[model samples]
Target chain A: MPTAPAGTLYRGREGMWSWVAHRVTGVSIFFFLLVHVLDTSLVRVSPEAYNAVIGTYQTPIMGLGEAGLVAAIVFHAFNGLRIALVDFWSEGARYQRVMLWVVLGLLVVTMAGFLPRHLMNVFGAE
Target chain B: MTAVLENSTDTSGSESQAGAVSSFQVTLKIRRYNPEVASEPYWEEHTVTAHGTDRVLDALHKIKWELDGSLTFRRSCAHGVCGSDAMRINGRNRLACKTLLKDINPDKPITVEAIKGLPVLKDLVVDMEPFFASYREIMPFLITSGNEPSRENIQSQADRDRFDDTTKCILCAACTSSCPVFWTDGQYFGPAAIVNAHRFIFDSRDQGGTQRLEVLNDKEGVWRCRTTFNCTEACPRGIEVTKAIQEVKRAMITRAF
Candidate 1:
C-alpha cells in the first residue's frame, strides 16, 4: 500500500543490462520452444496434417519472426557462456565488460551468416 | 555564543571564504514525502549558492538550515565512514557525504532521493530493518571451534589477503539497494550480506564456512543473484561485492560435489 514513485531508473552499466537482456531473451526462447513442440508433435496424426502445419510457418512474416527468434537465441547462448566464465574464472568479473563486447561481436557474426540465406529461402519466388 | 553560531554556517560564510573562489548557486530537486502533510510524494527543488569543495551533504544541510526547515535526512561523520548518508543521486546509489556537488554536474539540478528497494520513512531516511535483517542472517563474525587459543588466534598474511577486499564494508546499504533484483523482490539476501559472509567465510581463523555456505545455498540466497554488477558499482567502499557474492556461490557449488 506504501507504493510511491521512487526515483530515476538505476543507471547500471554493462553487467546489469546484460542480465536483463538475458532474462528477456530466455523467456522469449522458452515460449518459442513451447510452440515448436506443439507443432512438431502433429507428426503422429497424419502426413498431410504435419505438412499443413509446417506450410503455415513458410510465410514472410513467420520468416521475420524466425529471424527474431534466432537473434534472441544467439544472444542468449553467447551471454550464457559469459555468465559461466564470470562464475568459474577468477578474473572473469574484472573482464566481464570486455566479454560482453565479445558476446555481441559473436552475435553479429552468427546473425549475418544465417539471415541472408534464410531470407532467400523464405521470400524467393520458388 | 551568537558569534560562534554566526561563523558556523556561511550563507555567506565558510564557503565563500574557503578560498579566493566565490560560491556558485546549484539546484537540488529532492523527493519529499511526509504522511502527516501529503499522502503522496512530491519533487521539491531549492537552489543555493555552494562552494567548489561543498559535497551533497553540505548542500542538504544548507537547504535544511537556510531554505527549508522542514527538509529531513540522516547523516553522521560527514566524511563517509558512517554509511548513514547513502542515497540515490542522479540515478545512482552513492554516499552524499562523498559525492561532491561539482563532480555530479551541478549545472543541471541534481536529483536526490532515498536509496531504492526499501520503504521510505521520511524525506531521505528509509526503513533499514530489512537490509539489516539480511546482514544479521549472515552471522558476520569470526566463528571458531573449541580449544581456544591462550592469547589470540593468529592468521597468516596470505590468509588475511583472501578476504582483504571484502573487509572494507561499512554496511552502507548502497550496494544492496541499487540491486535490480532486490528492488523487484525484497526476499533476496542481497550482495551486502553475501559480501560480509565472504569476509568471515574466507577468514583462515573462522570455522563456520560450512554453516555459512548452507545459509547462502537457500532458494532466495546466492542462487538468486544474476551476476548483475550493480552491487559492485554502487559500493562506496570499493568492495568487490559481485565478486564476493560469486565467491560465496562458488563455495556452495564446491561444497556440493
Candidate 2:
C-alpha cells in the first residue's frame, strides 16, 4: 500500500490506544482486588466460611473463572508498567509497540502454565 | 565541448526558462459536502492554469471564481500572518498561501481538506469556535494582584526569553488540532492552551505562574497530555510544543515536591 501524506489520514494513535487499554485493565484489576479482599477478610468471620470460599474454586466452572482472573491480572500488570514507562521516560515511545507484543506474549505463556493445573485441581486428578 | 554544453538545454542547464510554460497546470482534489444535499462527503477535482509563483490560495480563487462559485474557505491575509488559511494540504496542516507550487510537486494532485477534529463548514473551511473556546479557557493573559508598574519593571535577558517561543502563537489552533489527545478528548486543555499557558507561566513581566499552573493543574489540564509529539511535528512556526509541554509538567512536579 502507498503511504498517504502526513495529514491525509488519521492513523488512530497507538500511544493513546495503549493508554486507554491500560486504564480499562487497571479498573478491572482494581475491582477484582476489591472482591479478593472481601473474600479473604471472611477468615476473620470464621475458618469454616473461609474454607467454604476456597472450596468453591474446586469446581470446573469456577476454575475457568479463576484462570481468566489470573490472566487479566497478569496482562494488566505488565501493560501497566508499559504505560508508566511512556508517561515518565524519554525513549519510551521507541519500544511502545514492541512492549505491547511482549505483553501479549506474557499473557499467553501465563495462561498456558496456569489453566491446566487449575483444571486438574478442580477435577481431583492432581 | 564548451559550445555543446552551452547550446544543449537537454539534460544540462538552461539560462532561459525552457518548457516553463507561461501557464502551468495544477489539479486540486477538494473534499466537498453539503448537509442538505448528501449523506457523505465526496471529492471534486479542478484543473487550473497557474503561474510558477502561485500559491494554493490562488488556485482556490481561480476555482471559486472561474469554475465553481460554491467553493468556500477563509483567508484574511494573503500573506501567512493571519493564520486563517490553515488546512490539510497534501495530508498535513499548512497555510494555503504559504504553500507554493514550486515547493510541492506540481505533477501530483494536491488534496485540500478541512482541519482535522473540527466540524467542516464547506469545501475547505472548518468551524473554529471550539478551538477558540479552548484557547479562552486557558486564560491566555497575565494576571497579578500587584499594582500596575509605575515604570518599566526590570528583568534579566534570560527571564524575558524564557517564554519567547510560546509568545509567537497566533491562536491558529494548528498545534491543538494536531494533538491526538485533543482529538480523543475535548476536555483536554490541548497543546495550544498549554503553549499559551507557558507564555504566561515563564514571563518575568507576569506574576501569574502559580495561578496559571493551578489552572493547568486541573484534571483536564497538563495531565491529559500523553507526549505524542504530533503537535510538535505539525506546528508550522517550528515551536517546540512537546518540549514546552514537558517543561510545564516538570514545573508542576517540582512544585509538588
Candidate 3:
C-alpha cells in the first residue's frame, strides 16, 4: 500500500458524483429498511411492543428523519432507473449526463408533490 | 507560494508583429518524491515565464533543463502520440503535452502530480506494471483459430470502422488510473482492459470474442463498472471508454442466459 496520495484530488464529473450519491442513498435505505422490518415485526411479540416502538417514530425529530429517508429513497429509485437506461438504452451512454439531469428533474417534481402533503400530515395534525 | 525562480528569456526589445502575445510568469507546484531520498513526498514550486502558446510540457522542460538537475518525468514523442506524460493537472487527469498553460489559467499556481490509482516510483513517474498486467489479461492481440491465411486478411472498411475508436489507445494508463473503482481496489478489470477487449471482440476479422468475454466475465470484470465516466473523461485520445465498457457489459449479457 502506498503511504501517500501525493496526487491532487480527482474531480470526477456528474456521472461519478451521481454514482456516489446512489451508493450512499442505497446503503442508508437498506439500514432504514432493516430497522423498519424489525420494529414492525414487534407486532408478532405483542401489540404493546409494537405500539411502544411505533409511538417513538411519531415525534417531530422522527418526522424530519422520515423526510430525509424519503428523499434518499426517491433519489436512489430515480438514479437506479437512470443506471438502467445507461445499461440498456442504445443512446444512453452518449446522453448519460443529460439523463442525470432528467433524473434530478423527476426527483424535484416527485419530492415537491410528496413533501408538502407529508409534512402537513406530520406537523399540521394533532 | 514561492518567489520567482527564473525567467525563460527577455523579450522587451524583440520585434512585435500583428496579434503578438507576451510572456508571463507561470508558477508550477510539482509533487516530488524519491524513495531513496525521503519517505514522504513534498510539493516543490517553481515559477517560469511562458507564452500563451506554450504547453505544460514546455514549462516542465524549462524547469528540468535550467533549474533542477533531478526533475524527472517520462516522455517520448512529446506531441501527444506516445502518451507517456499523463498526470494530474489542477485536479484533472490530462496529458501535460496537450494541456496549454494559458488555457488552465496561469494566474494560480498549476499543480502537477502523478496520476492516481498506481504506485508512484518517483516524481511524476509510476510503475505501470499493474496497468499493463490488466491489459495483457484480456489478450489484446487478435486471435484467429483457423488455418493461416493464404492471402492478406480480408476486411471491409465498414468492418474496420466498428472497432476503430479503441485502436487509438496508446496504453497510457490515463483512463485506468482515473477510475475511482480502480483507486479503491486494484483488482477491477477497469475501462482500459474492457476497451481493448471491445476492440478485438467486435472486430469482424478476429475470432476471440468468446475467450475475451469469458476473461472479462469474472467477479472483478466488466460487471464491476458502475458507469462512472471518469475513464471517458480521462482518455487523452478521446475514446468513448464508458460506452465501450457498457457495450462489453451488453455483450456479456447477450452471451449468458
Best by DockQ: 3
Q: Estimate each model's TM-score.
A: 0.91, 0.66, 0.93
Clashes of 2: 2
Q: Relative to the true structure, how large is the alpha-carbon lDDT of every model?
A: 0.89, 0.75, 0.89
CAPRI level of candidate 1: medium
State candidate 3's TM-score: 0.93
TM-score on 0 to 1 scale for chain A of candidate 1:
0.93
The C-alpha interface RMSD of every prediction is 1.6, 9.2, 1.6
| Clashing residue pairs for model 1 | B10-B13
Chain A: TM-score in each candidate? Answer: 0.93, 0.74, 0.93
Per-residue lDDT tens digits for candidate 1, residues A79-110, read: 99999999999888888999999999999999
The true-versus-predicted C-alpha distance at residue B144 of model 1, in Å, is 1.8
Can you write out model 3's per-residue Cα lDDT over A1-117, one digit (the tens) per residue?
674365667889999999999999999999999999999899999999999999988887888888899899989998999999999987899999999999899989988999898
Give the Å shift of residue B8 in candidate 1. 23
Candidate 2: where is the Cα deviation over 4 Å?
A1-8, A11-126, B1-23
